[model samples]
Target: MLTRKQHELIRFIQTRLEESGVSPSFEEMKEALDLKSKSGVHRLISALEERGFIRRLPNRARALEVLKQPEDISAGKTAVRAAANSNTALTALKPALAAPREPANDVIELPLHGRIAAGVPIEALEGQATLPVPAALLGPGEHYALEVSGDSMIEAGILDGDFALIRRTNTARDGEIVVALVRGEEATLKYLRHEKGMVWLDPANSAYEPQIYRDSEVEVQGKLAGLLRRYH
Candidate 1:
């Protein structure tokens, strides 16, 4: 069974990987969560792997693959809670309500600054690295990272697993790749073009049709500035 700390750590790692496509290093995890030492963080990670929540590769940095899919993380949480209750060692854990996290709007606050897409939930204070970006990279507003989930932007060379750097804005210029929120909790990556009172979500890929919507139902989350790809 996992302890409360272990469960929180698991969720953190999972969310970080989804946002950045890589797991945090032990030292980073230690600093992020305020652990006593890197070794202590390592122990918790090892325990998580042993319990089937994660799979670790020997000597590989950020090689931890969460065994459960991101969409099914709620189930994982329930399982971890059950496991904790069954273990006598975890009985001492009092529910530590998570501290109120800061909003990601502040520039000084840690930026979840890579691969940001429109409407993706990126909690502030979650990113580890202090981004040392060139002045050219900074836009007027804050940005976030979003892992490209589908191949809808293939014509734009925005493949799956690629990271889109998005500047937060509700307005976009024509021919720009914007993270758009469609009706029904559906977010998509597409080129935004204004036509009369309606907006058209044009995909670069020829196979997909351009989505048309009224301004009220569709929201422009941000405009894509660039992409970052990591090769393993």
Candidate 2:
């Protein structure tokens, strides 16, 4: 089995490839892995390649191609030839860890704009608000952005200063964090619970009570895809 450092390196490489559509440079690897120097990354990379977990092309920049994911080789099967593409390589080397075969989903790059208050209506302000999140995170509904207003969601781990990713909808799955426009005038963040003809916006912390709403009064903005926290 590969050591923890190797595992981390594999994951880092995989993420970089997915993001950039190519392998990272040795310098990038060194920075991402926090190695002392480029040579350190090269040594680990060579070790991985020797183990049949990766492939490298001579004299090519970003030449390292991950041939075996941790799960693939972990099953002890690096002997057989698999398909010739990166996806196949991942599956051949680690079938158990293979990601689902799905089409590319849309991911929005949201900026980390300013904050809003839960207790009062405030003017919306825009600043550096760029955060990339998968389209799947947005519920099957319309798209919208909400300026977080208060600390009500804080006890629930939704901070007051965070930008909440919101999708516009009226229906929400149970236990999903949602942006709900309550009473047509105010918005709040809470977990959704649909039952007994009533929808409940449950808070992550016990300090706040669940916001109950009727089918008509609740405006499901969208499932909270995710949040971006910024400090300046």
TM-score, structure 2 vs. true: 0.45
The lDDT values for all models are: 0.57, 0.56
Error of 1 at 190 (Å): 0.6
Q: How accurate is candidate 1 locally (lDDT)?
A: 0.57
Candidate RMSDs in order: 17.8, 14.2
Query: If scored against the real structure, what TM-score would every candidate get?
Result: 0.43, 0.45
Off by over 4 Å in 1: 1-136
Which residue pairs show collisions in model 1?
A: 114-145, 115-145, 115-146, 116-144, 116-145, 116-146
Estimate, for each residue in 1-232, the C-alpha lDDT of model 1 and write its tens digit: 5687787788887666544434677887898778999888888888887778777744434556565433334432211111111221110011112211332222232244333332232222124444322223233467765666666665455667765666788887787778777763566778888888998888766777788899887788777754544444
- How far in Å is the alpha carbon of 20 misplaced in model 1? 24
